[model samples]
Each structure stands twice: as structure tokens, then as C-alpha cells.
Target: MTRGNQREKAREKNLKKQQQNKKGNKNDGLSNLQRKEKDAEIMRQKQAAAAAKKK
Candidate 1:
């Protein structure tokens, strides 16, 4: 009986965590293409900075 209660509690905790993850995107509702473009731009900036540091 105690084991069953623990299992139920663990299941509920997992479900709550999943729900929080689903809501945690920080993209400001950008579409897929826009998000990709933004990420690419950031990567380019980082690469440029690294090259400058190496020089």
C-alpha cells in the first residue's frame, strides 16, 4: 500500500515538471524560420569575436 502511494506521488511530480518545461520557451513566439535566423546571427557574432581574440 505505501509503495503504491509513493508511485502516485512520483507520477504527479513528473507530470508537473513536464508541464513547466512545455511553458519555458524564451523565444517570444517567433516562428521557426525567425528563430533559426536569430540563432545563426548569434553564432556568427560569437565566431567573429573568437577570431578577433585569436588575432
Candidate 2:
């Protein structure tokens, strides 16, 4: 019975760690995507300004 209980505890600990890691990855990915989108928007704005200046 002790061994079984120990195994269950270990499994739960590992599962929790895995879930935390996945959450971290998802958060990182979302932030990177947002940064890229903002950068693209800035580039587009700069290009438009340049075109306006040329005309």
C-alpha cells in the first residue's frame, strides 16, 4: 500500500510539471507572435510614410 501511494504521488508530480511546461511554451509562443505582428505593422506604416513623401 505504501508503494502504491508513493507511485501515485510521483505520477501526479510529474503530470503537474509537464502541464506547467506546456503552459510556458504556449505563453512564449503567443508573445513571440504578437511581437512579430507589431513589427510587421510598424514596417507597413513606415513604408506608407515613405511612399507619401515620394508623391
TM-score per candidate, chains pooled: 0.81, 0.47
* Residue pairs with backbone atoms closer than 3 Å in model 2 (clashes): none
Q: Write the per-residue lDDT of candidate 1 for residues 1-55, one digit (tens) a residue.
A: 9999999999999999999998998788999999999999999999999999999
**TM-score: which candidate is best?**
1
Q: Clashing residue pairs in candidate 1, if any?
A: none
List where candidate 2 sits over 4 angstroms from the true fold: 26-55
- Each prediction's whole-model lDDT (CA): 0.96, 0.88
lDDT of 2 at 51: 100
Clashes of 1: 0
lDDT of 2: 0.88
